[model samples]
Target: MNHETKRDVFEGLVEELANAYIALDGEGIGEELTNEEKQAYMKDYDAALPDDLPVIPELIGKYLIMRKHDRGDLVQALDEGTSFLLDGTQWESVQDWFWFSDVKDSVDTFARAWVLGVWRVEETGEIVKLEEEK
Candidate 1:
């Protein structure tokens, strides 16, 4: 995607995350939230849904339409040019990743990659490649 679209997608993702968090917070499933707080959170969340908020419906469903395949977020959400299609694809980003038997599968070490960003696979090895907004 072009920089403009990528920028839009990135911003959209931020909003999407905010809405999700707000909903979860509004649920007040934790013991920390007071009744008033829950009410206030829900009030704001509901009020924004129908507002002039930009809802990228395509993203509202699924950001990528590519065929089913392995996917993950790794340690955190990746930015532009970091994530790509297919499993183990990210290993290509790491020069020495081939040393590990399952570089594409998991990283037991607390690794850091300046170019690819820092991450370690907790359960299973994944490229953490999710489809980008195309």
Candidate 2:
């Protein structure tokens, strides 16, 4: 699927999951949920999501490496040393590069990188570069 379509699907899935979670009861799996339980669950979920979540485009399930092109930047080399994976909610290092030791800073920090390529799996289960698919 195209990036936009994939993004839409992913967002729909997230909404569905959130709704399902909210509908679940605190006691039995199928019982009616209390308002307190729903509130608590929503609080935790909202806390986990980043404040800048909307700025994150449809990069879910993508693996990538980015390099800064600006020549005047002194930390360019360090920025290019690690690969990253964006799993909907957060950005994580694919390698042990220690760039994002603080979980809160990882997503916003990675967003600043100049993306070299995005790798995603096809419907047939083969992984390919997004550019090559075009």
Candidate 3:
């Protein structure tokens, strides 16, 4: 999908998740959900997604990773191309991936690959660059 279309679909999925979360239990007078119960609700929401929308794996993975690491800012930064995740080898391969390949005038390494920046976290929890944006 194109950037705008992909973003619209993602937003729709997010809205669905949000609505499901709120509807899991009607707003209570005093009974609040425990953390575990909240997680269980999210799991159910995930399981209930229709099987036909398999492309949503990336969106779900992104959300789960960011949530696990408490990295909302990082997600925004990555979206803005201010951060990078792949190493040189992986970056080269990704240029062939549809996300880049489907873009207008996007180039592969055979000519000059347009690097899409994403942040990489090392084992030491250090954020590092995968490539310089050309």
Candidate 4:
């Protein structure tokens, strides 16, 4: 796939993941939330996600590999420059590297930090802690 196509796919995946997270967060409190309250919550959640996230090539490659594994579509992933399909060793390697690596840890950390109003600097990718409102 081209760079633009990859970016679109990555963005769609991010949106899907964010919506799922929002839905999961609201699960038990759904009944208590008014329409305006839910809208505000969604707005906040959207704002928490960085709009200027650079499309990290490694992350996008891993995402495509995961999608190929899940959907059994080797051709598409290979077309996008993934080497092997999810065979035994390749599957284990992909799982270990993608799911258990520092990349995942960083993502988890970012999400946790975002909940506390910390954000990443788009240009430098530095983590900044936001001051709490009185």
Q: Cα-based RMSD of the predictions, in order? A: 16.6, 14.9, 15.0, 17.5
Across residues 1-134, which tens digit of lDDT does each residue of candidate 4 receive? Answer: 11123345456657755765667654453234467866755555554544443222243344443553456344443343334443333442334433465554543443343344444443455544444445
Residue 103 lDDT in candidate 4: 55
Model 3 RMSD in angstroms: 15.0
Q: Over the stretch 1-134, how does candidate 2's per-residue lDDT look in tens digits?
A: 23323444446547756786777787644444588866755655543322222221233223333232223232543454354434444444433323434344444443433232333232343323324322
Reference-based TM-score of each model: 0.18, 0.21, 0.22, 0.21
Ranking by lDDT: 4, 2, 3, 1
Kindly give the stretch of ten consecutive residues in candidate 3 with the minimal lDDT sum. 108-117
lDDT of 1 at 86: 41
How well does candidate 3 match the true structure in TM-score terms? 0.22
Stronger candidate by lDDT (1 vs 3): 3
Q: Highest TM-score: give the candidate number.
A: 3
**C-alpha lDDT (0 to 100) for residue 76 of candidate 2:** 47
Compute the lDDT of residue 126 as modeled in candidate 2.
34
Flag regions of model 4 displaced more than 4 Å. Answer: 1-92, 104-134
All candidates' lDDT scores? Answer: 0.32, 0.39, 0.35, 0.44
Task: Please give, for residues 1-134, the per-residue lDDT of candidate 3 as tens digits.
Answer: 11223344556657756766776655543344578866765555453422222121232224324333453453342344323353222233322332454334322221121122222222232222223325
lDDT (tens digit, per residue) of candidate 1 on 1-134? 11123345445646755766666755553234567866755555443321211221121112122222224342332222133434333323222332333434223221222112212233442223223335
Best by lDDT: 4
